[model samples]
Target: MISRISALIAAVACAATLAVSPLVAHAQDQQASAASAAPAEQTAAPVAEAAAPAAAAATEKKDNPYSLGNIIAHGNTVDQAVLVILAIMSMGSWYILFIRLWDTAKLNKEAKEVRASFFKKASLQEGLKSLSETGAFRYIAQTGVDASEHHEGALTENIDHNTWVTMNIDRAVGEVNSRLQGGLGFLATVGSTSPFIGLFGTVWGILQALTQIGVAGQASIDKVAGPVGAALIMTAIGLAVAVPAVLGYNWLVNRNKAVMSQVRAFAADLHGVLMGNRKVAGR
Candidate 1:
């Protein structure tokens, strides 16, 4: 586009030079004047070329009131660093959320399978056989049965069969709960701290904007409003980063509880079966 403008300007200069050539009264002076006009046109084109970017940039700002491009472009290193940090936090929060959701879904599916199949078996061995070897319920059932059978060992001399089995099953349940709870703390941290990080960005932005206002020696509303409002975007972005992390943390924690409830229910029933001496004898 600049090239086209330059070409058109050069053409206009040539035309004007041609039209004025007859009025010069001397050939050499006319030549000199034409040469001077050529340099002037060349200089003007460069000036216009330089100014195009500035005008376009201003237009862009006017086109978008809260211009992210302008913010990044004009923002100092600290401002940019804050933006980068918030972006990373947002991304990490989402990644953790996805991972936790997948883990929770797998647990829920296994629980549903347990509900459908594990309890319906005719005996402890049958139930344990029916469960998937990799599943949480299967692990608890196997651990219980193992404890029930290991009651004669020297380690079992002090602990009663019931207590030992309960301890083993409880331990298994706790481990399962731990697995369910793995990524929630990061989510909580993100939620609790992201807004403050964003607020820091907001504060930094306002400070810089105000500093700029001071440098220019003006307290006019437009100057103050534009930069201050743009600075406030940092706070808005921080909230955007923090909200999903918080909500996801609460939701995933609750879902973990639901999964754990199913685990506890199975553990309780397994405990009853173990306490009844279901596997103590040959059968």
Candidate 2:
């Protein structure tokens, strides 16, 4: 009976050991699963944060404002160098236009006054005095009289007199022509070079655009449009400045030609008066 009791006790102990072993193994499995999943959760957190910024950036990119109106309104569009060139061209054009207009008008009025004074019974000395009130026409008439006074002689005795008079007349006319051509050459130069200067700005802007694309790692419209639009603004400004300069140059040139024609006619009329119809061989 004692042996039977001992065997039963041993069997009970063995059953308890087997049940406790399974419980401990289940707890270890749960711990292992939690440890493994912890690393995965930590890794996913950073990925989610990184993805969030990218999504926000994409949204912002969609709302980019590089339009013409936006650029103009902001006054953030044009390059400074391009702006300077445009301003210079514009101011120069207006300056030339105003200066030449006044100069031409004065010249015309003075010439008409000189003609009237001569026709209204002014002697040579009186006519010169009347012309002397204005410098431009005065210089012209004085040049002819000076030339005639310097070369006073008979035709056979003074062969060089005609040549001297012609030279002095040409010199005075050339001086007047120089005044007429003033500022026009600069206008032409501005017209010719403005496009090239703007083209340089455009190229520089394109280079900047490429740099931005490289940094952003994508070539979206937002990434490219800003620089391109800014670049085009420079080009357009250049053309806007250039067109007026070119037109001004052409207009001034034609007006100069007209003024020079009047000068030549005045010189011829003076030559006829001073030398007489028979004395002046080439009327």
List CA RMSD, all candidates: 14.8, 15.8
Please, what's the RMSD in Å of model 1?
Answer: 14.8
Which residue runs of candidate 2 sit more than 4 Å off their true CA positions? Answer: 1-78, 152-159, 277-283
lDDT of each: 0.84, 0.78
Give the alpha carbon lDDT tens digit for every residue of 6-81 in model 1: 9999999999999888776588787899999999999999999999999998778364445667678876687788
lDDT of 2 by residue, 125-222 (tens): 67777765556877987888888776655763455756676678888989988998899988998899988888877887788789989999999988
Backbone clashes per model, in order? 0, 0
Q: Candidate 1, 263: how far from true, in Å?
A: 0.9
Could you tell me every candidate's TM-score relative to the true structure? 0.70, 0.66
